[model samples]
Every structure is written in C-alpha cells, then in structure tokens.
Target: MLERLLDNPLQDPSGYRQRCFEVKQDAQTDKWWLYVTYCFPAEATARSRDTVVGVDVGVSVPLYAALSHGHARLGHQHFGPLGKQIRNLQNQVVARRRSIQRAGRRGVVDKTARAGHGVKRMLGGTEKLRGRIDRAYTTLNHQLSAAVIRFARNHGAGVIQVEDLSGLQESLRGTFLGGRWRYDQLQRFIEYKATEVGIEYRKVNPAYTSRRCSECGVIHEGFTQAFRDQHGTQGRSARFECPACGYQADADYNAARNLSLVDIEERIRVQCA
Candidate 1:
C-alpha cells in the first residue's frame, strides 16, 4: 500500500483504472521510494535527435564509445582506480566470510550472544563494509554514465547505443578487470540517464562484436578463453587484426565502431524521420 499521496497525478485517483505502483525500501538505510506507472504518447516523450554514439562495455576498458558523427577515443580509464576500491572491498568480504565460517565451525560466540545480544562484531563489520561497497558502486556508476552521456552529447550525439549484455554475466562472473567489468549496472545507469535527459537509448545483441572486423567484412581468426582472464591485458587487447583485409585497430575501439555500424540503418532512418 502507498504510504502517502502523489504530488502530481495524471490519471483520475477516484475512478478505477488500470495502474500499478511499486514501493521499495533501501535495505541499508531504511529509506523508502515509490514508483508509479503512467501512459503517454510517444511524441510527448520523444526528443530531437541528430547523432548516435555506439558504446562498448568491456572487461579491460570501462567504456569504449564510437560516435556516429565524429571520432571516438579508445578508453575511459578513470574507472580503473574506482574499480581497485571495489575489488579490494570484494576481497575483504570474501576473507570475512571465510573467517565467519571458521568461527561457526569452532563454535565461537561473542560474550553477549547467550544473553540475546544482537549485531555480532563480525556481522556488523561485514554489513558496514557492504554499505561502503554499495556507495562506491553507486558513485562509480553515476560518474561513468554521466560522463559517457556528456561525451556523446559534446560530439553531437543525441542517441546513445549500447550492447544488450543480458547474457554476458557468466562470461564476466569472476574477474573484476581494472574495475571495468560492471556492464549490467553501467548499462542500466546509461539507459536511465539517457531517458531522463530526453535523449534516445537503444541496445543491440552483442554478438561477434570483438571478432568481426569493424573496417572489413571478414571475421578475425579468434581470441581464446585466456582473453577472459583479468591479468596483464588479456581481455583488453590493445589491438585487433583482420587477416582478410589487413585492417588493424584498438580492440575496444573496434568493438565500439562495430556496434555503431550495426545500427547505421536505424540511426539514419530516425534522423530522417
């Protein structure tokens, strides 16, 4: 049930209507948020469009964006340091979990545990660490997403294109490569910000984005599972090679370009429309 009334209601409140609402509370802070649904025409939400930038999220680089209208750089390395913090935090959590398991096996308990005491020291530290990790994630995600959108807009891009990484999780499950491996959260942030700013957001299936050469039509030989490793630039290959046409470019940049090219027809159609 809703705890309070809405400040702005588009539909009639008294009349029965098909509507939905969601209420969520922040687990760590105990803060509440409400989300509601509203229906509106496409033109009412659509914005002016000129160019689209195709973005590639990867393990080596935090972001590799290819603009439809202009040149694009290869990497957003600012996330490297932030990712370090996140990885360290995750390591600490793993270590704590191990210690907790050991203690449980040994039947160790705090002095007040038998007195109905709450919040064990280890549990408290873990929760506090979890909170810090959450904040770091939120900060990193917001900064990365905002900067990407700003960069696109500066390059005359009004629509942002990204890979639909719905199935990429298993591939990136373990390694946190240079703090650049949070594709799902990053993409979600990008999607929401684009919508909030009245820009366009589109995602395409991310298949063969790395293997297919951006310049040539031929698919490159291939990269191996070693490419999935986090150490020493395995995933973030500095360069890619096309055997058929001898085309060479930065690996991440090549992927971004391919993503941009993938949506060329649609981008052109939308601009013309």
Candidate 2:
C-alpha cells in the first residue's frame, strides 16, 4: 500500500525524502502492518513575497481566516454536527457499559450461565459503535487541516498565524475546546503542512483578540460574546459589538481580524528598536 502511493507518477515526490518505515497495529484491524511516513525538505516551496493571514480558531466555528482582501471560514459546515455525533456516541457507549456492568453484578443475572456471554456481546457492540464514530471525526479533522494549509498557499501568504491554544483546552473541557485532543491534532497537521510548504507559522497571545475592537483597537471592557451560526446570523451565538467604534461582526471574525494585525505589530516593535 505504501509503495503504490509513493510510486504513483501522478503524485509529486520530488521534494520529499525517502520514506521512513514503521510497523504498527491499526486500531480497526487489531493487526500488525508496515507503514511508511513521508517527509519533505524544509525549502521545498520558496517563501511567498507577500501576504500574511491570521486564523482565528474557535470551538464553535473551527476556523475563520482573515485574508488581505476578504475572509474565509475553514472546515466544513457539517464538522460541528459530526463532532456532536461523535461526542454523543462516546457518552452513550460509556453509559451502555455501565449499564451492562450493573446487570452483570445483579444476583439474578450473575447466576445465569449466559450472563458472561451476554455482557461480552453488549460490550462488543458498544465498542464497534464508538469506533465508527471516531473514524468519522478523524476523517473530518484531516479535511479541515488540509483546507487551512491550502487556503494559505492559495492566498500567497508568507505567514500563517494561529493562537497558542496550549492551556486553553484544559481550561475549556466540555465546551467546544473540550475536544482538546482532536483540536490539537488538527493544529499539528496545519503547523507541519504550512512549514513544509515554506509558509512561516506563528502563535500570538489570544487574550484580547476577541474583546478588542478590530477597527479602533479599543478594548470593550465587556462586550457581549456572540456566535455566528451556519445560517450566518450573529444573534444565534456569541458575538462582539464594539461600543467605541460601533463595529459589529461575529465574535470570532472580530478576533481573526485582530489576529491578522499581529504580524504588523511585531514589525513595528522591531523597527522602533
């Protein structure tokens, strides 16, 4: 399988190094198999001469990129729904296991010869359901990551800025950021892909990205946090309406615009010295 993918003439393999081999057991198959990891040279792509994009990532929206001329939302509309499905299925599986264990512990059921077999079958079914849910989410995450990298390349962006979400996920479990495991996974994909293509990646302090007015730089002190739904209505979610400048936009987009200015601010600080 690895050999065919690498040797495919239609795929570009010029800038990549020799494939590194590894043997691992796949979760789906529970069997050992050989795998090849592909790598790329650092300078495979020449750096772009212009453009910098700020990507504001959120639990609700996933990503909102602020570009030079306009903006784009990364990831698919169904991503949120799919995530909900995965999480719900996960919870259901846990509950199902607990119920099965409780049944096994009861005096009436434990005496039956079929008890052990019945519990095993129930557990197996739950495990299979959870696996399918996880696979769906994994597929979606890969797509989101690829879309973000492509967005940067297509825009001729020299730099792609993302928030440092290190501790935030731990702090926001149960919320959108609660899926820290998968969110971080997607982030790593974007980071490496961007670097491999010669686009610099950076992380900025996300503290005030949402609260500060993107138009005038005034911190709203306490702006109402809003959300922009799939239908594009701000009233449905957390939002920011800057009282100082009366600039209204989705809370996440406002953050993205502010994030986009991080590179400019850094350059000014450097020149002043």
Candidate 3:
C-alpha cells in the first residue's frame, strides 16, 4: 500500500516536487512504513489575499469560520461531524483497553498474563492503542484543515487567520492531544495547504477575542466558557450574548468573526469609543 502511494508516475505532467521522506517501523509487527512529502508551485488566483477568513478552534466544534466583511459563515455543519466520529473511535479504543486492564487486575486474565508485563499485550500493546488514536487525530486534522482552506477559496478569501496557541492548555485539559501537538498539527496543515493556492495564513493574538462581541465590539468580561457551563449551553450550539447591545449568536461563530478583523484591538477601541 505504501509503495503504491509513494510511486510517482514517470511520465506524469503534475509538477509535484518531492521535499522529504520519513520512515517508521511498527513495534508490534516490525513492519516499516514510508512517508513522502511533496510540494508544488502555488496556483495564482484572480484576486490578491486582501479578504480574510477568521477561524475559531474549540474542543467540540473543532472549527468555526467566517468572512471578515460579510454575513457568510461556516459552522459545525460544514466542519464538525468528522471530528465527532473520530472522537468516538478513540473513545471505543480507550474503553476496550480499560476493560482489559480491569480484567487483568481482577485475575480474570491470569491465563494470558505474562510475568511483569501485566495485560499490556493482550488485545494489542500500548503502542497499538496509541497508534489508533494518533491515526484518528491525523485524519481529523487533515480533513478539517482542507475544509477550512476550501471554504476560504470558495469565498475568494486570500488570507486565513486563526488565534495563536496561548491559553490553550486550559481548554484542552481533557482532550487527547492536550491541545499542543494536535493544535499545532491542524494549524500547520491549514498553513501549508493555504500556501499551495497563494493564500496567506496567519496566527494572531487571541486576547479577548472570545469576550469581544462581533456585533457591538463590547468586551464582556463574563463571557467565558464558565458562563456557558452555567447556562447549560455547550458544543456547536453554544451561545454568546452581548450585554451591551443585546447581540446574540453562536459562541464560536462570534469569536471567528472577531478573529477575521484585520486589527482586532483597533476595532475594539473604535467601537468602544
């Protein structure tokens, strides 16, 4: 399978250039896998990247994107179902492992247990469990990132902006990737994919992005995730209400609109004034 994928056609007209190669060996089967990275010249667009699409990342929805200047928006319906499917897959794998561990601890698997090895090798080793989770996240990241890029391109957006990875530790406490590796992976995929089509990608400071209202620009200090918890609103349908202007919208969507602005701080100042 790897060979078939890596085999580049000899007379292919595609201008793909091989950039790098990576190889890894599976601990369970001792099988080796090869990964080849390729790059191609950027395809020019009719317009420059003057328009921007703001993307907000979160645990449930994964991504919420919108145009900087218009009413167009992309919500969970566009980029969230796959993430939930992948999360369910990871949960199933974890539940099976836990069942094995419990059985081993209760002496139910004494026949299959090896000395000093517990039941780590029963269903599959720890490595195998980790591999399944990793593969799930990798697929989720690629599909979600590709969807974001496609959304931007279809709307003629030249620039793609997302929040910088600060304070992500709090939001990702219970997540599988712990917010670091997975967040970076998704960001990098979007950036590289955007670059392939002459689109500019940027990570902007995320300060007050969630609190600031996209409708009125008022920074509601109380509009945090904790507030959502109190209101019993979560997931893709989470709501954000502005106390100042009585504006209400999906929490992630409001944040995404704020991120789409060129100068978030300046816009806040002007609106607040």
Candidate 4:
C-alpha cells in the first residue's frame, strides 16, 4: 500500500515513504509519521573511554550543549544572527495570517456577505508564506544537528545526556504559551544524528538542575543574577556563587553538572540491577 501511494505521488501528500525511512503508526497521532535512520561505524578506538555530553533545551535559543572534556560548545551558532533571521521570518508569517483574517472580516462588513473567493485567495497567500517559514526552520534544525555531531566527534564525546521532556506538551497546558516549543523535533534530530555516528544518547529527569547550586548542593528557588549579586556578589554574567563556599560557575555549566551527576546515578542503578 505504501509503495502504491509512493508510485502515484500527490502534489502535496500528507506524508510519503521510502527506504531507510519508516512512517510507523504510533499512539501519539492517529496517522503515521516519517522517520529516517542511518548507521555508521564508530570513529574512536575501542580503548578510548566514553565521555558524557550535556544538553539544555530552551525556547529562546533552542539548545545549549556542553561536554565533559571542554573541547567544544555545541549549538552556539543557533543563538546568533541566523536565529534572529528565522524569528523574523516567523513573525512575518504570523502577521500575514492575521491580515488575512482581518481582510475577511472587513469583506463581510462592507458587502453584507462574506466574499468567499477573496477570503480563499487571501488564505492561499498566507499558506505560501507559511511554507517559506517552515522551510527555513527545517534548514536551521538540520544545520544545528550537524554542528552537534561535529562537536561530539571533535570532543570525543561518546554519550549525550538530554532532559526528559517527554510529556512537556501536556504538562504546559493552560500556561502563557503552550505547544510553542519544538523540543520533540529537536530531540528527534539529535537522536537520529547521534545514532548515525554511533554515539549513545540518554535522558534524565530535569528536576532542580537549574535551581540547586552546583558547588554546594544548596537549593535556591529563584536562583537568578539578582539573588546571587545581592547575597554572594558573584559578579555579572551567567556565573553564580554558592553562598556557602563562594564557588563560582556559569549557570548553564552548573545545570550540566547536575545532568551529568544524574546520568552517573542512573548508570550505577542499571549496573546494580
């Protein structure tokens, strides 16, 4: 059936199938979704031990990545000019959509009836604009994933640790902004690229990583710069002081430490079991 569908491809089919790619039926959505897989030999020697990598996912910059060896900072490019360009394109798409809706409303008010053809044409234009934005986003995601792979290979990072935000969509319901973060998309790209390079990926619970002080294990509920500067005077920037020991570190680096610690605990549990 899939082969037949592929044989007579539609102009814009919901999805398609091909070798090295699978569109499996899953519980999340009723229809099948696409996934591609690639396999390759490991680059490192058998004697080279594993090094852990930590990743922090966010909405502003998308991803922040680090490794234990300090060889590279993956996903830094994502926060610069390219990211601004993508955001601008997305904003244009949103404005165009709103304009189309307003135009439809005006047509009805002026003509005492909806101008169906005009409304359809306006919506078609919005769709084309949306397609361009989506393409840009897809391209950026691919670039970011490639950068991550290169960083891992250069740093000799064998394992990648990610926060388990599996049910984030449901958990964020009724919040200020829901279903806006593309965490699942980023995760899928990371997993696929890592597997292609024979790198191990793991997810751990993201509890108290950003709140607890990395040096002293002190839990500060709102551990922001304002709190740190007033209490411990840890200077400006992403660094914070432990208040107990005056140990200073970058905020993201501290979070990464927690992720690594949790990963080590999980590994020990698995070995014991």
- Candidate 1 lands at a TM-score of 0.68
What does candidate 2's lDDT look like per residue over 1-273, in tens digits?
455555654556554544567888878559697767766556555555456677776545656677644665443363566556645655765676676666557535576657767766776776776676566556766766777778778777788888777777654442343443466776787788787788888888676666777777777766533323333343234567788878887676777777777454553344345
Clashes of each: 0, 7, 0, 0
Q: What is residue 25's positional error in candidate 2, in angstroms?
A: 3.1
Clashing pairs in 4: none
> How do all the candidates rank in terms of lDDT, highest first?
3, 2, 1, 4
Q: What's the lDDT for all of these models?
A: 0.63, 0.64, 0.75, 0.60
Pairs that collide in candidate 3 are none
Model 1 worst lDDT window (10 residues): 1-10
Q: 49-75, model 3: which lDDT tens digit per residue?
A: 668899887534667898988888887
- Candidate 3 shows a clash count of 0
lDDT of 1 by residue, 140-259 (tens): 778778877777656656678787767666755533443235567878889877765667888876666766677765656454335434223644554677878888877777778877
Provide the TM-score for each candidate, comma-separated: 0.68, 0.72, 0.80, 0.66
Best prediction by lDDT:
3
Off by over 4 Å in 1: 1-50, 74-83, 89-93, 96-100, 103-119, 174-183, 225-238, 262-273
lDDT of 3: 0.75
